[model samples]
Target: MTRALIADANLIKKVQAGEDPIGCVLCNQACLVEDVSNPIISCQLNPDAGYELEPTPKGFFQTRLKPTRLIKNSIVSIVGSGPAGMELAVSLAEAGFEVELFEKDRELGGALRRISNAGVGGVWCRSLTHYLARIENGRIKTFTDNEVLPDDIAQMAERGPLFLATGSVGSSCHSTMSGYHNWISSSDLLKSPLPAHQERVYVLDNKGDHESAWAVETAACFSDEVVLVTADPSPFSRLHKTGDLMPAISRARSLGVKFLTFTEMRAKGDSVEISKRFSPQRELVQDHMVIEVGARESSRLIEVDGNQTRQIFEIGDCFAPRTIQDAIREARCYSRALLELVAT
Candidate 1:
């Protein structure tokens, strides 16, 4: 409730005042657990959120980003335009680095772009990209729809430092049970909204996070019988870890979305099969299926080796798939490192 009020009511007041609200993302990551030990509790978007206090040991979260030593317009190549890459680009540019941003997609905002379509709280996810893009505008040179291949990394590194945040690829059980042709990712479904005529929709809650919940919510829009299948005993069980379990379940049930937990899906010849534990397996319908099983790091570009002349830093999901908070904070830390390195 407090987080919601700050993000909503307080944010509104700030906007009305014509102030840069900074838009509290309401992630509740920092303050939620800062008192336990070394305090890193601070806003992910705000670089100086905890500047008044002493710095922590630079864990998953980072704060107090200061690039006091300015560079002489040295070029820094940032690969992938996800939240992490965008944040790093803006951070480096602010520190006087000539930023060269690249994205394979047509636009910026890697996973957040697709995340925006998932369900509630999506608006902020999308806006975050816009916020970073706005800050980097005219400051960074962006190359969208341009993939930085493995071969291209060494070339870019030859010129300057490379920050690779190649993001990740979503996967589900459907990946192993291919050839059915109806299986699709929740993100892909959001990008290409499902047809209105769908009779039923099934979502594999492999993620058990907001994305999985978001998929079920999005699926409910087009199909009356939206079913969420999960291996966990309680569907969307992970939401409780972030203070959203009950709400997600309530919203999902209100939307007529059903749950099938402790269940597994299998490939039976040309068709897919599904059944709960200790239950008889039944052939599944050939309807559209949305999988929210999380993703693996996209590390194809990381295979190439770096040399003494140039340094290649893999940030965010490329380092290992994590939250947007981890992404932005890591970028902030790197930006500070970049300044210290090149300034000397």
Candidate 2:
């Protein structure tokens, strides 16, 4: 059955290149959000996701027509080599600008790397691999294992433009949980080592996104029993798309993980106490707890913006916490606008 599904030439090619052609374990935000606003079965990663026509749609085939470069030989220092920073750096480089991207981590890709390592990112890892390959051959100079401080930004701004895309940090758990000793952040669990041999795991789903779903799945892997408590009515509530949501739900069910919707959870010693929201109910207990709340913009570099240069700008999660596609699109638009400004 799996062999039959891998019969497509394109899928074969992708697999041969060590890429995931089918699994897209994204949050399905673009698909659902687009459906609400308009009615397109679009994908955040692929521009031509669901469009199938004779000659294909005009927008599907349309490519970015490179404008005449006016910003020549300008050196742009970009902080944080995440999706937003990489997209902006590549755009600026293509526009005949020298780009130097610095990442605090040893490698690029930011959160995607950690998410991929958690084995839940699906095709997101392929996107990161592609981006890394592009950066390797592109004119953009990358500096891994380098943290860009505010002073560094000021110094860079003295030469030319300085862009920040420092991504986001995990949001602190604000739940009225009594115990903090055994609690772990979602990002920390994804990046660091997982807890071994948990008897009972409780995942607090604050985001109601794929991350929460993935957290449940991850916990289920190491724990004998798992419980996901969320204020939302359903797991992956934001993921209304058929392609993304069903598989995620199926995966969770297969792992024997229980879902407690419209519930609030608090820590109580060795056990996590969960209660039904707006109901007279009994509080259930679990041995371990993981908080899968969303993150806030991490931008200490932008806090002390002593740079007087008009070119100093912040993009990506540093500007606001959003999806990877949102960050890339914003960076691309801003890069084009900057080019237009220089041209004018």
Candidate 3:
């Protein structure tokens, strides 16, 4: 409806003149947010969201996102072969459309692969294999180690439907702080080799996600004095009733990983300045400082102007730095919409 209003000036005028829009802005209150026990998906705002399929009272629920064989010639260009991009590409390709997938990294699976390799085994890691299998099939034409530039977007836009799923990046304290001989982000630790360090390992848990805890776990295994400093009262607090946080926390504790909650930490040369909530600052000399705060959307799509294109859409982390579920949901919905365009 937002896109329709933008394209059709008369519709925008009608909406301004007290007319109702045709779409929901996906506020993710009832549909997205849910308890671990009852995974029944029902949208409070949009009744049509989960009404297409039979409602399951318990267990994991799947969507009715089957492929629609539309135009065989219409090529869909997808940037980033992550969950969102890969999901979208697979859907479109299965729908009898040619899909060209571009990934900046040499391999596929974006952040999903990174987390999976980080030894954070669970549903997330399992899901990576599923997505990888789907995209690795002969249906999608994938380009690895190819970062899509502005000129590339412009060229692809002229060809056919273009979607941007260029994921996100981990937050670093290097922007604010100085020194700390060895400084690494959560993603850095997850992907690259562990930096050379002695005893002290100070992990700055910023966002308090599962990734932070897993990174802390990895750090704890190597370093003797592993201290997790976080602003949140509890790490991985966002993972409501997932039954993942508590066990991981317990394991980290067993591994001698100390927790310092409600604290702010910054790197200062050879030492790190740590301050508790409403407390005076104290510097702790550490050999390694790993910062795991949060992630920001990749600016690849933002920098590239796709206005001149026929149909351009951005889904996943490129759209907003949300969960894997949110990215997959958005991709599925948008792909359905684009399929309609091909049908017309």
Candidate 4:
């Protein structure tokens, strides 16, 4: 009748109905059937589910499970709440550790959150929203708009192991001769509204990868003549899969976009000077120029105090620029390593 005793009845019913209930029944108790709908326990055989039941070190659950032991009351501090930091915090909390995540941005999700809101990238926005919801419901604590400095490491070290997952910085072209009225980095372009002009546009693919495609998609929405100029023979070669490249190329083609491979940009009045591979240089006037170069790690925190911190561990783009998948994987591996060290 009650929730605890219902399992017994179910077991007995299963056995009477010509079924082996041994595997189905978890508690080691003899079932006595008083009625088809109800059953009584004749003997309490296994107590504490095959282990000595004791209050965990954290006083959460009374069990000797390995997972519970690895986490009980352990304090973990994670800097940055991007995929890597957030995933690590959630994983640690689920294992029973007290986790606190710090983020510099006003909101979570890092670059993905900001870029996803840009037109034509709504899918990323939706995925990030779903992930943020899970983090909110979990035991992990998030502190936004808090930048972690090197001095902050000492404070976190006193509590538990520290994880640094600061993201990367966008690289922009600082060349003054590159002529264009509007020359903004990809990061800035993704955040701000496009400049007023819907006719001619030029996108410099200095990163030589999927970011080039992203720039093209964004510019295509506003420009009639959008050109993607890249230094690489195959501009999207850095992307891992061909399947991923197909859809982006298809979208650009549908918008009547132009791809200029092995090309470099120079300044020509209010327009851009383009030099194609094995072709004569020509001046092409454009309304906008979006530059998607590359990114470098922002490791200012780690370089403080002449790098005296010995326990310093850098995960995600702060150590090496990488994809979201790589960042999440590194965080998981780092958390597991920390748990193993504490257990021993």
TM-score of each model, paired residue for residue: 0.71, 0.73, 0.70, 0.62
lDDT of 2 by residue, 1-344 (tens): 33223222266677899964533434344444445666755444433333333232223112222222423555778888777887788767867788898888898888777665654567567667766765776788888998776667667866666777877665454455535566776766654567778888777776766677678777877898888877888887765543566767788898898888898877666666667888888675554556555634355465634325445677887777776777876776677666755664
Best by TM-score: 2
Candidate 3 per-residue lDDT, tens place, 1-344, comes to: 53333223356666778954333333233354365686655432223354446432211111211122423465779998877887788778877788999988889988777666654446566666666766676489999999888767767865666788886654443343445566666655654566665487777776666677777777866777888887888866665445567766777888888888888877677766778887786756565655554533354554534246435667787776776666776677666666654464
| Cα lDDT, model 4, residue 219 | 79
lDDT of 1 by residue, 22-110 (tens): 55565554435434675554555654455434343343111221232323444788888877888888877866678899988887777
TM-score for predicted model 3 compared with the true structure:
0.70
Write one digit per residue (lDDT tens) for candidate 4, span 264-325: 77666787667776778675655565555452335447652322443345677777876555
> What lDDT, from 0 to 1, does candidate 2 have?
0.66
Candidate 2 segments exceeding 4 Å error: 1-33, 36-71, 173-182, 188-199, 221-224, 266-273, 284-287, 295-297, 302-310
**Model 4 global lDDT (CA atoms, 0 to 1):** 0.60
Give the candidates in order of TM-score, highest first.
2, 1, 3, 4
Worst 10 residues of 3 by lDDT: 57-66
Off by over 4 Å in 4: 1-74, 118-130, 147-154, 172-183, 187-201, 206-210, 219-225, 233-242, 253-256, 266-273, 280-290, 302-308
